[model samples]
Target: MRHTRRRLTWRGTAFLVGAFAAACTLVNVVPHGTILERPFVVEGPVGETLDLSYAELTVTEVRTADTLESSFEQAVAGGTFLVVDATWRATDGYIVFAGAEVIDAEGRSFWATSRGGCAKGTNSQPGYAWRATYCFDVPRDALAGATLRLARGTHGEDDAGQRRDAVAVVDLGIGQHDVNELWDATEKISIEMPGFASAPATDAGGEG
Candidate 1:
């Protein structure tokens, strides 16, 4: 009976020690693991330029339109169309800006749509800024506190391509108060295809 008690006590102690070691490993490993996996996020408000290591990005304008017009196709929004105009200047030799998504205040994400000549992704060389417009069909609730995330890597499940890369996160500046007005407005936006910012379709040309 004494030997049996001793064996039980030893098993209990071993189990406790193994659990403590696992807890310590998690405490040391989890934080460092998350840090290494996180992207280097460059954040800024709309109309301000952010340096995202590989490129510079500026969200120039934000608007909602009932209709989108282009030379080839026209699209009407099922919900409201959120149009985001941005300028990107690559500092690296040649880069393709592949990831574009809008994250709302509630952490809901909306990917950019390619309807009506809108650009879902763009390519640039290290010379000048390229201007492009991205659009999303979102509900009225998503209009407030929406942010635009642009990156060289494409956003896949679990942020697959964006890991450990420099990413641009720009706020669209739409507040809760602006939601009703933006949603109610039935305006048409004349969107041009992605082009060099130095030469707009017509030259009001500001440095992008």
Candidate 2:
């Protein structure tokens, strides 16, 4: 009976050790980066509309310039001004989009500049689509492989407000060749104020 009890004790110890090893293996092997609370990113290119659960987002166009012009204000960029045209159609009630960032290929993020009458974020309702332009002052290296991310949450705290929400990500489709041409551009782009959706109209605007 003594020998039988000793064998049982050893078996129990071995079972616990095996269970711990399996747990450790799972912790190391599982993809921890893909957390369950992460945002659901809807990706697309320019001219394509993406349904982001809360609203419909589209990046209409992207242009580069050295200066930005509005009706009463003018602003210049030390690097280059990237004018992004976008439209949003709200699905639910009133929504305010505060998350807007231009993320480059090398993981560099540039925030929108409202200095040139560009919009930082947008507020819209569910009736129709409204357009806004977001301008980013970015270096030449950030033009290529850049994507625009928009969400209702603020850009602060590592997009903490956007967690577990649907965020829209649109590629600007810029290449290295395009970067040089854009960087050399000396043209001034006209900035428009935020307004409702117009006929056959799409939007562009962010703060400032």
Candidate 3:
């Protein structure tokens, strides 16, 4: 009996050691959510044209509003609506701009809001530039030091960390003082989508 017990103890110890080694190998070799696996990010500021290897993106205007107005429908912001005007010129044939979000100072990310018939993403061709307006409804605190990120692929394409993609990061240029001023003020801004007029009808402003 004593001999049998000793053999079982050695077997259990060996099994445990083997399991631990396998786990260690997986931790080192497998591609998890590590930053090393993410795609390369290109950053720029508002009004500056940026290249993402396959496309050229320009952030034209960034505005904050408490409420969005138009001739037909009105959409109000819970905290504020971040309206971003951007133009895209594709260099490598036709493609779709898939990723769009806002990253606040706290590293918190907010996806683009498709309300008010706004263009969540833009489709581009090789010929001319395409204009798009992305709206994000975020809290008051999200405006300060926020950055907008747009990528060639959708969020799912890059979230797996298996694809090599190009991303454009643009600064929203929202300052500390601007946050208060934006939250309290109501602006009647007009948004128009050209190059693709048939895409959607978005006219955000007060009564016509």
lDDT of each: 0.87, 0.86, 0.76
What's the residue-level lDDT of 98 in candidate 3?
80
Consecutive 10-residue window with the lowest summed lDDT within model 1 = 199-208
Candidate 2 lDDT tens digits, 132-185: 999999998889999999998876766777878899889899987788898999
lDDT of 1 by residue, 94-174 (tens): 999999999999999999999977999999887777899999988899989998999999888878789999998988889
Show where candidate 1 strays beyond 4 Å: 1-33, 199-208
After superposition on all C-alphas, the RMSD of every candidate to the true structure, in Å, is 6.7, 5.6, 8.3
Best by TM-score: 1
**Sorted by lDDT, highest first, which candidate order results?**
1, 2, 3
lDDT per residue for candidate 3 within 1-208, as digits (tens), equals 3454455677899999999999999888887555556766789889887888888788888887766665556777777889998877778999888888888999888888766656678797765667788888899888899999887777663454224677888998889988888777687555554354221121232111
Query: What TM-score, computed on C-alpha atoms, does each candidate reach?
Result: 0.81, 0.80, 0.76
True-vs-predicted CA distance for residue 41, candidate 1, Å = 0.6
Worst ten in a row by lDDT for model 2:
199-208
User: Which window of ten consecutive residues has the lowest lDDT sum in model 3?
Assistant: 199-208
For candidate 3, give the lDDT of residue 82.
91
Winning model by lDDT: 1
* Candidate 3 segments whose C-alpha is farther than 4 A from its true place: 1-32, 70-72, 194-208
Candidate that beats the other on lDDT, 1 or 3, i.e. the better one: 1
